[model samples]
Target chain A: MAADRVTLSDVAREAGVSLATASRAINGSADRSVRPELVERVTAAAARLRYSPDATAQAMARGRTTTLGLLVHDIADPYFSAIAAAVVASAETAGLQVSLATTQNDPAREVQLVDLMRRQRARAVVIAGGRSAGSSTEDLAGQLAALRAQGVGVAAIGQPVPGVPSVAVDNLGGSASLARALLALGYRTFALLTGPRQRTTAQERCRGFSDALGAGGGVVIARSETPFTWEGGHAGMLRLIDDGSLHGVDAVVATNDVMALGALAAARERGLRVPEDVALTGFGGISTLRDVVPALTTVAVPMGELGERAVRLALTAEGDVVESVGCDVVVRASTPDLRRR
Target chain B: MAADRVTLSDVAREAGVSLATASRAINGSADRSVRPELVERVTAAAARLRYSPDATAQAMARGRTTTLGLLVHDIADPYFSAIAAAVVASAETAGLQVSLATTQNDPAREVQLVDLMRRQRARAVVIAGGRSAGSSTEDLAGQLAALRAQGVGVAAIGQPVPGVPSVAVDNLGGSASLARALLALGYRTFALLTGPRQRTTAQERCRGFSDALGAGGGVVIARSETPFTWEGGHAGMLRLIDDGSLHGVDAVVATNDVMALGALAAARERGLRVPEDVALTGFGGISTLRDVVPALTTVAVPMGELGERAVRLALTAEGDVVESVGCDVVVRASTPDLRRR
Candidate 1:
């Protein structure tokens, strides 16, 4: 049954044309000057044989695939989903397909998926989310160079890879602004919930927030290392509550919005009034957070734009290797103005 | 620059082997009985030439691509993202890569994407969400038949296309159960916020709830047709409130969770206490919905499992055309038991 499958070569044979001529006639290469009659003959033969141009065969014949590979940290996370959606939309508009892979923040898995994308000869590989510090940058750079050597475009959203262009969110600047805003609201003592220790994004955000707080002479009463997930924030907040570490904390600042949501749930479970007993803020102004009472005061990074800009960066690559986007500190009811107190 | 790409023919010439032998060795085909030393020579030469096996060429020789195509309504929607995440995980486990596309509920775009997948030779095509009634079923059937004839697997999640295997959700049964639960809680009046009226899933769910309510002699004061989005639900609820239709309504049931969250926000904005001033419920038990205060009372659909099951059904085809999964009506703090009223 497999032997009966139609191939481009079969189409060429049926059309009584050379493989190269049939390919050029079908694919309509810019450099090829094929006769109209030959193009018509090939098209008619393909129609009669019900020959569909297999993307893989075309990729082999012409050194490019219509597909792009998108590697995200986790798709189930709304933040990444928003970006993934934008990436898919941008790819579609550019007449390209997306092959999505999830790394679950695993450095080894990220490297493996990149190799797979290379093998598949995707037009570009878009890495969404922050790169893990655990992965050796030299190895990743070498792999990327090989892809570029093959004429494949490489771009990242949030993640920074040497020699590869990226659309990066200003995490440090955004978090620093959040710290300033919170301090202005009279949150002097704080507890911070950080994602995986190895994540450079989390580290940068933590450092920026810490620096701003230090400048204001505000103490970080407690720090918790948690997964970059809601459950992590929930569990971490519960542990903080149990440990009495939040005893005098004026506010809780989570590295991401999802974790902040978990912390809010924990505070609610313990009957803590938001903005009254404790103020809470998060990074990543996710859409769903809009409906949460005392809306999450967060760093509004344009998640969708990140995906779009990443694809744009890949498709229209100039000499620029990095494009940085700014984020805003959106204050909502989640954090109250301490000046009133 | 284009001529510089190393081809299989070049690798074969360098290795002193026939092109066919090099291909078989590289593809690891079972039919060929090539000598081990020849295979080693071909592999080393290919490596020395920096020759990565072109996946497209391999697909032409092997009759299929290892990539699966997943078409969803919208990936940004949490419901779809959950399903997508599951599908990607399952495909990875099965040693398949996934190519994702979004129709944004556009039927014409769906057909166009399906054709693109056909051209790309996706191993299987999984269409998530309900099919648009506007598209001719026969036309879709013909497309599926062609895919199957080409030896590609076809499975749909929640969408029922004739002759295509599907993993369907029990939307009607679940909605009926939700109505019964609500009725038992002593709510005599209700309002419904349904997705676009043309959506079959929305129509079926609305019908089920309406039928159950009619059977109980309960009254639905109003019904609003809205987009399947949070803002839609919010605007719908506000309209219902402004029209005084919800003046005496005991509860509002949204067709999906995101919308319900919107309705919850609308009620909060109006100074209504959930379950005290009014009750609220939503369908599609999305995980993020858990963080909402007064945990949403919803029908739990294993969205991720649906995606996984669809892929499994496509992979292990045993002539079964449809697999129906049940949903549970989870009672939470959002909807108070009216029996005590």
Candidate 2:
């Protein structure tokens, strides 16, 4: 295929230039000599021949660039930010460079950004937050398979991107722990604030919360599905309070910190004292949560560690890849007394 | 300067081939009729001449590729996260794409990243938390100057890069506002906690804080500088408490959220109740702080907006261009409280 494709020689022949001269014209070497007329002809020839210089081919022939690419949904999210920091720190230790990219969780933008990373000659790629390019898991599977064939490393955070190594907190385990904590506080009725039902992290956390709390068949009478944004949490909590169900429910466990924080605000506006009147718990112990009043009693996933591990996994050889690791629980003062205040 | 370089015609002449055939040999786009021997000759001639394709040349002839490069210091910092989010959203809105590359305040990495971004043909470049390459501002300046010469749109955030356009907050005003707020509440003595003196934002904020309060007859006594990180703030606060001079100060002004949070923690350890005892205020109203007890009195910087603006400015031509905007002060219960606790 390389032989048949229009090579630099073809452009040289078409422009009636020496091989070295053609290379210089194409590369724009500073010290080389060239006539304006010859430069124009060489350019025209290059275009006519559809020459690309093939960045991928260059990588293969010249060894690796020792760079990897990382794309995420929202870097502002403490979860992603924590992971990113960890990843960069780790990458530095490994003598590898990371190229970071972000998608606002827009699917089209996700595909476009990933494509560009591939072109950058990245030997490995990490996708955090959003789903892959395909509409179906199978499609995502195919994308992974394609990357495998090309010898590119791929890993993801959040939902395991088809065949990629993924690192996550045992959402189910952690949520169960949180639920048990709230349950012990003698909270019968519960208000569940959830995230987008699609993402795996949200779903698993919800399941964990339910499994531990409802395991004994207590009560989880109220719930709302909102975006995993701070606003969503704020709005969701307000809605729970407005429904008057918050009065009946003794506890609130948001899928993430933002929602949990929002729930706290809503309870406050409703004249409820946290832990006294209504115990509130959030997941994802981000730095922001550390300063929250009655510091969040939540799960602290090693976000930065996840990022670094994800990168290492992607860079690992194809067949020898390890699976995933679990995160830990971080309990603060958010849930003090369990009963209604 | 562009015209004096070697041309493709020179290669064809040396290879004894027609211009089109030489072009084919060089670019690897040749029909079955093109002989392998001719291609060899073309490649040999090109190699002998040491050809290098002009990156800018290829870009001009080709339509813009769908990629943007973003550089920042620490993504884990809520400030950078907000900016990164804004940039990604803005880039998505513009139908342009972005790839992230973090410098982590390392000058060598910064230079390497810039080179990588240039090689990737990023449509524009945004550098947040940039520093001197090799920890020397001179080296960092030299690289930025080189990129400018190549016509790369350069925009920075948090601090000015001499000739670069920077999207930064009114740190001076914001700090002054916080100080002014405390003064209004009758807190006379203060111990300020600041980030590294090298950080532009940190320096600007310290200046603002001191200018506003220090000029008030040294009422703000002294300040300690720490890393622009949480632990730094924590350690600084501890130092103040152990030094026994804290009794002379009734309030503390921290430069940023992480440090402010550390201060809050330090205060709690010292059994100081917020507002009623030692009033506290933090700059950069980050997430989770809203959930903290006494809700940090802070300046809610437009972090996302800063990021979006930085991306836009990076896309524009460089010159004496400047954009500065005001931030909002969030009055929580941390400052000198007038309300009876």
Best by TM-score: 1
Which prediction has the highest DockQ against the true structure?
1
Evaluate every candidate with DockQ and list the scores.
0.64, 0.21
Question: Which parts of model 2 are misplaced by more than 4 Å?
Answer: A1-67, A90-97, A116-121, A130-138, A180-189, A214-217, A317-322, A337-341, B1-67, B92-97, B107-112, B115-123, B130-135, B198-200, B214-218, B336-341
lDDT of 2 by residue, B1-341 (tens): 12443456877777778877766655543233468998889878767775433222233234233456778877777878788888877877775556666677677777777776655545677887734322466556566666666556778777666777777678899888777777776667888787887776787888887788766544777688888777888899889888876776778888888888888888788887776777788887777577777778898888777888887787775584668868888888677465343
Where does model 2 sit among the CAPRI classes?
incorrect
- Tens-digit per-residue lDDT, A1-341, candidate 2: 21244677888998899987787677655355678888899999889887655332233333344457778777777788888888777766675556666766776666666655544445677777745333744555565555555566888776666566665457788888777766676666788888887866788888988988788566788888988887888888888777777767767778988788777776777777777667777887776776666677778767766787787788774563445556466656767654544
User: For candidate 1, lDDT tens digit of each residue in A103-127?
Assistant: 9877678788889998787898898
Q: Could you give the fnat of all candidates in order?
A: 0.73, 0.39
* Residue A289 of model 1, lDDT score: 86
Deviation (Å) of B101 in candidate 2: 3.1
